[model samples]
Target: MEGLVDINRLASGEAGRALLERVFQDDSERFLRRLRDRVDRVGIDLPAIEVRYQGLSVQVDAFVGSRALPTLWNSATNFLQFD
Candidate 1:
């Protein structure tokens, strides 16, 4: 819970799984709030903002999706190596 949490280790336990979920939820909310503030400060119209938000969301989804496969592969390989 302090520094450098290993996702594979965290996923292995109930408490760690809950903590990971909470962390991700909090991070996502924080990111949206910051994005909203930035758009407001820039005086973007609602329609334009929505477009930008959609673009940002797609990028984030793609980025996270891209990394997930590699992370899972590495985790499995690591577990196999250790086991």
Candidate 2:
């Protein structure tokens, strides 16, 4: 599945819930509670974010748009170029 990832920033449970609600189309409050329960039961660090359905993991990445992509204008520039 195609997913968008914003640059890292501090997050709170409320924000996490909102994000999940918008992206996953599920009940964020319930999902958050369940996630917390699972983590407490297993005693491990819960993931900051994850997007998957069934068995397939969604691939997400952050990228600047065409203005940031390499073009004829930057073709001569080295090192900083992005394909």
Q: TM-score per candidate, in order?
A: 0.50, 0.24
Task: Give candidate 1's error at residue 9 in angstroms.
Answer: 1.0
Off by over 4 Å in 1: 1-3, 48-83
The prediction achieving the highest lDDT against the true structure is 1
The digit string of per-residue lDDT tens for model 2 on 1-83 reads 45855424423467875775576655666799898899899999755887768877778544466544777654455335533
TM-score of 1: 0.50
Task: Count backbone clashes in candidate 2.
Answer: 0
> Which candidate has the highest TM-score of all?
1
Q: What's the distance in Å from true for residue 68, model 2?
A: 52
How would you encode candidate 1's per-residue C-alpha lDDT over 1-83 as one tens digit per residue? Answer: 57886799878899988988999999999999999999999988776333334435333223345444668776686567659
**Every model's Cα RMSD, please?**
17.7, 17.8
Query: CA lDDT, every prediction?
Result: 0.76, 0.63
Q: Clashes in each model (backbone N, CA, C under 3 Å)?
A: 0, 0
TM-score of 2: 0.24
Pairs in clash, predicted candidate 1: none
